[model samples]
Target: LLWETMILPIIRGNKLDGYVLGTKLCPPEFLPRTTPGSTVKIPNPEYEEWLSNDQLLLGWLYSTMSSDIASQLMQKATSKELWDGAKELSGAQTRSRIVYYKAELQKTKKGGMKMEEYLTTMKAIADNLAMAGNPIPLPDLIVQILSGLDAEYTPIVTLLTDKISVSWIELQTNLLTYESRLEQLHTYQTDGIQANHASAHFATSSTTNRPFTSTNGRGQNRYYNGRGARGRSRGRGGRSSVSSSSSFCSRRIVSASCHLFYKSTTLFHNLGMCPQIMKCRYNWSYIKF
Candidate 1:
């Protein structure tokens, strides 16, 4: 369990030095070299057993070291292959790799693997190799050999491509659906507002009275008591009685005449009649009072 969880990533990440050191301590050839001698035969069996156990440990170590180196080479080769596919895509691919590396590094917070780091470093090396136009590295050549051993590679690629195509179609469909819904909602709201305004206009038109009347030959109508001259005299007499102690009596007759003329002219004007009276000209006489 510990080997699977802890040590596998180190092997996968291409940190070969640690694996090599561990494997060199124990080699499988050491077992077969032990012989059954006349005097040494007694201890020979134990020695041979020890060699067998060591060989098992060494085998795991060697395999891990080999895989780590291979993963690095594979990453570099894959980058080159992608670049060779399209020259225009090189920068975009490099940027995407960098982003992927950064995100992977961040995920290493809880004692994660070194493979991600090694792969990132290898990608950088690959980018440099591409820029220099140099020959492919030996380890990368070995990776190409190893990749051919996996029969599922083509199937995995096809599966991933199909998934990406489906995702793109789904995304486009969702966007179009959202845009159509938004347009419909906007149209509905606009129509509702216009309909409400029209309804309000109709209601107001129905309730409000017309201030002007062409049927009566009047531009505007005015309310007045028909007994205007008599009404004015009675109003003045009532006012005089109420303020009898004041000097308003000195201008009483002039005030009464001004009031009667103003009412008469205003009434005639509202009736669409051009009154012959020049009462407005007499306004200065009332101003002096």
Candidate 2:
């Protein structure tokens, strides 16, 4: 009666140290017998008690270690190698804790820890790092671990795919387009003024000694007089003269044809190679091939 009166208050006050003493006072087999029903159905209360204490101790240890590790990771501002190593260690520790919790949860017949709880904790850590603007480099490793967990516990592939797709988009958007700049240059060159006033004036003025008058009211003298006009007229009238030069016209046509061919080839190559373009296509079977 005295033991009950003294110990009951201690247990009621939630003093686990005193409760341990009380548990020790009872015979080891006493708990299993009082649990009721078949012997095989009874839990090992002592082991459960030890596991509960161990879980508290391990949780504290991991939390303290994680905090220190995270601090160390943040302390080295310029060393990518150090940061990567720290991130790997952090992932390993978190994965180990998850594995431990998963095993413990499986042993329980009722009210076990859920995988969602672990995922929430992992996501919290990852989000915190992301908010800091320097996410961990081992996201692929983390995804692999999460994917394995999903396969064993639940299907989280959709969530993983969503995350990876964002990164893929960012990567693809940063790719350089060489053909685009080349096509712009080609268009600019082909459409630009081929000959200027300086070259035309030199050609006309060199044939005559007369001073010319301005014809366009811009105060600049026109160079072509009667002699210069006759020279230019003869130059334009004959096949051997400047205007009817088949070589120049043929060269221009050849250049234009080459430019068109190159532009078409570039467009076809980019269309076939572009990831966004490749996603749209009818199969050969759909085309009756």
Candidate 3:
């Protein structure tokens, strides 16, 4: 059989065919030429050509193999020997080989491989086993895939394990989706941290550029607005060292020209000290009470 067009276009497109495989070209020592009519064997010519082509084919086959297989077959005497040895070696899916594949599948952790790569690797192993006459059941395949995952995938693993049945395709899709969600969550958290940092930096810069004291004169009153003096004042003149009292004067003290609100009606002209709000016109030490 040759590389089929419909099954694998890539291999067929590469121009490799089963021509060499179907035509068993004998080694140079085994043959030289074929007689046209006589049944008896006769070596006439073309032994050199056969030797060259066989060695060339053998090298080509060796180049296509992995290092392990190539190293094992590197000492074969001819192309046909190498081909037959390779076939015999791979064709035997013995119990030990099956066990080895299963162990390999079990131990293949998803450590740092991305979601797609991890799944592809696992699937490749399963496909190999299937080709070797030991197909793993769907449930076991799903279980093996989940078992190979790290702790970060525990949430999805738990959800799937709790169910009685799950398909491989479904599990694969879910893992990829979960991976995407994890990536998005990480991105959003990073963005939020960056925003908070920027906000803190802006606040610090604004504070550094701000003034600690008022820029107006002590006589300036914020309440003397063009609209009207309607609210509590906010100016240097209104600054006082004392707390606001409940009445015009919380204490009774002598004053010369300041007035006080006594009992809400009586005006004690010379009996109390002036409140900080009052614009006193005289000294309180000379007051007559």
Candidate 4:
């Protein structure tokens, strides 16, 4: 933007600034002073006018330039010389700078970054290339951008590649729209998973919180109190109970698995498995039942 606003227009042409197509408009040799041998010769009006305009343009360039750049061109006698020197300095680095920008554009990935961030990264590199006087053509830049995106963006990339010509504005709009669509899909999938988990949790909790009673042949009754994965179950026939993920209803039993205990009138049953109940096992990687 700065180049377009200030540098570009001035580099084209300006007769008042003694510049035509970025070259100084030199005065003719006859225009210089030819005073007597007094050693105090004043410049002719035409030559003085040219000198004044050159100084004006030179000062303008210096005012717009950074201190380091202006310092480098301190030996320049005219605006065109200063600008040419600046161009020479810029040219010396252009090849390396262009290589770096092209490599970045080709290798950059959209992984884990937001859409805006990815676009900004690509655009900033392209702009720097333009500032170095080696602007990447739009079609090539688009190809590079498409190449750098993750596989998730392939559908939109394919659509763009099929077109004959795609403007930059159109490309950004499509990319951002596709990104929003991806976000929507991810949100929907997350909601579905959470819903399934909630249903499973509800079923597990409700079925495990009831007391189940069974009768023996001799009029003896056994009561089984159920608990969830992290609860305790108790047997009514005996005073002893063991605790685990489920419950152990034995007089003397100790284990880490889900268990159930029941005692008939005759004797207590050691670590017995729960009837028609899930026995859950847990570890860092996964859960099993």
Predicted model with the maximum TM-score: 4
lDDT (10s digit) by residue, model 1, range 150-253 = 24234433443345234324433443454455456556545544543454445344333322111222232232223342211111111111212222222334
User: Which regions of candidate 3 are displaced past 4 Å?
Assistant: 1-100, 214-289
The sequence of per-residue lDDT tens digits that candidate 3 reaches over residues 1-289 is 0111132353235433232354545534434344786555455356666666667766776776779878877788776677667776765534556777888898998988898999899888887677666889988988888988888789999999999998777888899999998887666545544543454444344344222232344443322223334434344544333222222222223131122222221322322322321423354443334
User: In model 2, which runs have C-alpha deviations exceeding 4 angstroms?
Assistant: 1-251, 254-289
Q: Please identify model 4 stretches exceeding 4 Å from their true place.
A: 1-5, 11-43, 212-220, 226-289
**What's each prediction's TM-score?**
0.20, 0.17, 0.43, 0.64
Candidate 1 regions with alpha-carbon error over 4 angstroms: 1-166, 210-289
Give one digit per residue, the lDDT tens place, for model 4 in 1-289: 3333467565456544335235456775353354576444455677677777778877887888889767877988877787778777766667788899878887897788898899889989999888766788989988888887889888999999999999999999999999998887666545544543454445455445445443333343334455333333343343323233344222212121122122110122221222212232222122221
Clashes per candidate (backbone, < 3 Å)? 2, 0, 0, 1
State candidate 2's TM-score.
0.17
1 or 4, which is superior by lDDT? 4
Q: Determine which window of 10 residues in candidate 4 has minimal summed lDDT.
A: 257-266
Model 2: which residue pairs collide?
A: none
lDDT of each: 0.37, 0.39, 0.59, 0.62
In model 1, which residue pairs have backbone atoms overlapping below 3 Å?
Answer: 13-115, 14-68
Error of 2 at 248 (Å): 12
55 in model 3: Cα distance from truth in Å? Answer: 23
Q: In candidate 2, what are the lDDT values of residues 1-289, reduced to their tens digit?
A: 2222343354446544432343423224334443465554355677577556534533432343446664565433222333245446656655665555444333322123243444445445544444333344455434533443423223234544456444533322321122234456556444322322233334344444543333332223334445445221212221222222122122233234334333444634433432212322332222111
